[model samples]
Target: MRKNTIRPTDIKLHQKSRVLEVAFEDGSRFSLPCEYLRVYSPSAEVRGHGPGQEVLQVGKENVNITNIEPVGTYAVCLHFDDGHSTGIYSWDWLYHLGTDFDELWAQYLERLEKAGHKRKPAPAAG
Candidate 1:
C-alpha cells in the first residue's frame, strides 16, 4: 500500500458567516459551506457501509460549525450549534472534499432537485 499525506496550504475563516476557505498545496481550493460540510459528513449518520444506506440530511440549510476540535493529528471534529459533532474528518477526507467539490456539489443539487427541494440561503442572524 502507498502512504498518502496532505498538508493544508491555507485556511481562511469567514468570520461573519462561519464559512471556511481551505486551500491545499496541490492547487486545490474550496469554499466549504458550513451547512454543506455538516450534512455530508463521513460519519455513520451520513455515510454507510453500502448504497441505499445514506440518510438524506434535512433541516440543515442553515447549520454552521462554531468550533473545530482536532482529533489526534489527522482528523478534526466539527461542532455545530445543532449539536452535531460525531464526525471526525481527516485531512485526506478534506482534500477529497475540496478536490471534488464542484462535482459533489452538483450531485447534491441534483439530488435536491430530483427530490423537489430547493436550497435556500442561510438566514441572516437577527
Candidate 2:
C-alpha cells in the first residue's frame, strides 16, 4: 500500500437512484452519479492515450451502472449500462473524484458547452 492512500470501507450501488455511494476509511463519503462516472471514465477509450487525446463523452445523461467488479485490492471496474466497462477505478482516483467532483463536473459541463452540446435535465425522482 502506498503512503496516504485512502481505501473505500464500503461501496453501495443505488440502482434506482443511479448513484454509487462510497465511504472511505478516512471518514469521507461520496455519492457519484453514473453519468458523471461514465463521462469521466479512466478507460483509454474515454481518457485516450495522452493528455490531448481525450475524447469528450456526450449523450450520457441517463447512463447507469449495471455492475461492479473488484479488480484485486487496488481497484474496481465499473460496468455501465451503456456497455462501457473498461475503466479501472483505483481507490486514490475514486477519492480524487469525490473530493474534486465539483470542479471536475464544472469543467465537464464547460467542455460540453464549448462543444455545442447541451445536457438534458436529470430525471425526477418518484
Candidate 3:
C-alpha cells in the first residue's frame, strides 16, 4: 500500500465530546472517538510482541485522553485517562485510523462479540 504524503495541520481534543478532531494538510478531517483510539492503541501491551498475541481491550467506553505529547516531528504520544501512554501515534497511523474508522470499528466490535465481551454501559441520561 502507498502512504500519502499528507500530514496533520491541526489536532483538537474535545473533552466534552470525547473525540479528537484532526485536520490534515490535504483538507481531510476526522473525528475519532476516544474509545476507538484507546482500543486500537499500538502500544506493546495491547499489540503484544508478535502476531496472534494481541490483547483485547475491554471496559473503555468512557476512557478519555488526558494528554497528547509530541514525539519528535513524526508522532504523538497519547496519555489516556486509563493510564495508558505507551502508544506512539505516528502521523501516518493517525491518518489511517481516521480514514479507516468505520471498518476498523466494525471489526473491533466483532472481535468483542466473538470473545463474549461487551462495552461498559454509557452513563445514564439525565
Candidate 4:
C-alpha cells in the first residue's frame, strides 16, 4: 500500500503564545501548543528505547520552541527552550498529532495524574 505524503503549506510559530500553526496541502490547519509538541517529541529521550519504555514528560506547560529547522524534505527538527532538540517530527506524525489533539491531550493529562506529576500552576488572577 503506497500512501500519499501530504506536506505542510505553511508553518508559523507564535513565540509569545507558544503555539505552532501548521497548514497542510489538504487545507487542514492546526495550531498546536508548544507544550504538546515538546512532551510528545519523537526523540529517544522522550519516546525511550522501545515500547512500554515511554517517559512521561512533566512540567512542560511553559516550554517554548526556540527553533524549527527543516529536516531534509520529510521532517522538521524542533528545538525547545528546555534543551530538547532531538525529535525529528515527520509530516505524517505531525498531521496525526494535529488530528488527534483532543484524545492525545486527554491521555497526557491522565498519565500526568497517575504519575503524581503536575504542571506549573497558572498565575493567580489579579
Clashes per candidate (backbone, < 3 Å)? 0, 0, 0, 0
Model 1 lDDT per residue over 1-126, tens place:
116857677777674676878887777787898777886788888887678897777667877787888888777888887998988888888887877878888888888888888888777766
Q: Best candidate per lDDT, number?
A: 2
lDDT of each: 0.79, 0.94, 0.90, 0.91
Clashing pairs in 3: none
TM-score of each: 0.84, 0.95, 0.93, 0.93
Q: Which segments of candidate 4 are over 4 A away from where they belong? A: 122-126
lDDT: the better of candidates 2 and 3: 2
**True-structure RMSD, every candidate:** 2.5, 1.6, 1.5, 2.3
Q: Across residues 48-81, which tens digit of lDDT does each residue of candidate 4 receive? A: 9999989999889888899999999999999999
> Candidate 2 — number of clashing residue pairs?
0
The reply for model 3, stretches above 4 Å from the true place, is: 1-4, 124-126
In candidate 2, what are the lDDT values of residues 1-126, reduced to their tens digit?
246889999999998889999999999999999999999999999999998999999999989999999999989999998999999999988999999999999999999999999999878988
The model with the greater TM-score, 1 or 2, is 2
Candidate 3: tens digits of C-alpha lDDT, residues 64-107: 99999999988899999999999998888898899999999999
List candidate 2 stretches off by more than 4 Å.
Answer: 1-3
Q: What's the CA RMSD of model 1 in angstroms?
A: 2.5
Model 1 quality (TM-score): 0.84
